[model samples]
Target: MSELKLNAIDFISFAVAGNTFKLKANLIGPNDQFHSVNLDIAPDEIKNKTIGEIEKLALQALRSA
Candidate 1:
């Protein structure tokens, strides 16, 4: 099996709360400050979705957050 390496310059995390799933993107500011954005996507929204579809939604959410 091949290991998948993501060239992510920022931080990301996945979490679940009850029936909703949360995706967060963390950033470091120029002054070494920390900030984060959270996107809560319902399970049904991404259910049965393709990898590409999910990725697209995730990126969109990140941008909006």
Candidate 2:
């Protein structure tokens, strides 16, 4: 098997709830495994974060999906 790594994140949807945001995404991993993840984060945490940073956070959530 190939090494596990984050390949891509297809952000399918998003919505705001209270002080946080819920992002629905398809986390693409090694070997084309797709994991659906609902990542909830405070806007303050990612408002200034780069796309790469946000993707990293989403990928982390995918691990527990």
TM-score of 2: 0.58
Candidate 1 local accuracy as lDDT?
Answer: 0.48
lDDT of 1 by residue, 18-52 (tens): 56666554444444545444556677874676655
For each candidate, what is the lDDT?
0.48, 0.60
- The sequence of per-residue lDDT tens digits that candidate 2 reaches over residues 1-65 is 12334445455344544667666655565657766667777767757867677667766775554
Error of 2 at 52 (Å): 1.1
TM-score of 1: 0.37
By summed lDDT, the worst window of 10 consecutive residues in model 1 runs over: 1-10
User: How well does each candidate superpose onto the true structure, as a TM-score?
Assistant: 0.37, 0.58
**Backbone clash pairs in model 2 (N, Cα, C under 3 Å; residues 3+ apart or in different chains), count:** 0
Per-candidate Cα RMSD to the true structure, in Å, reads 8.7, 3.5
In candidate 2, list every pair of residues with a backbone clash.
none
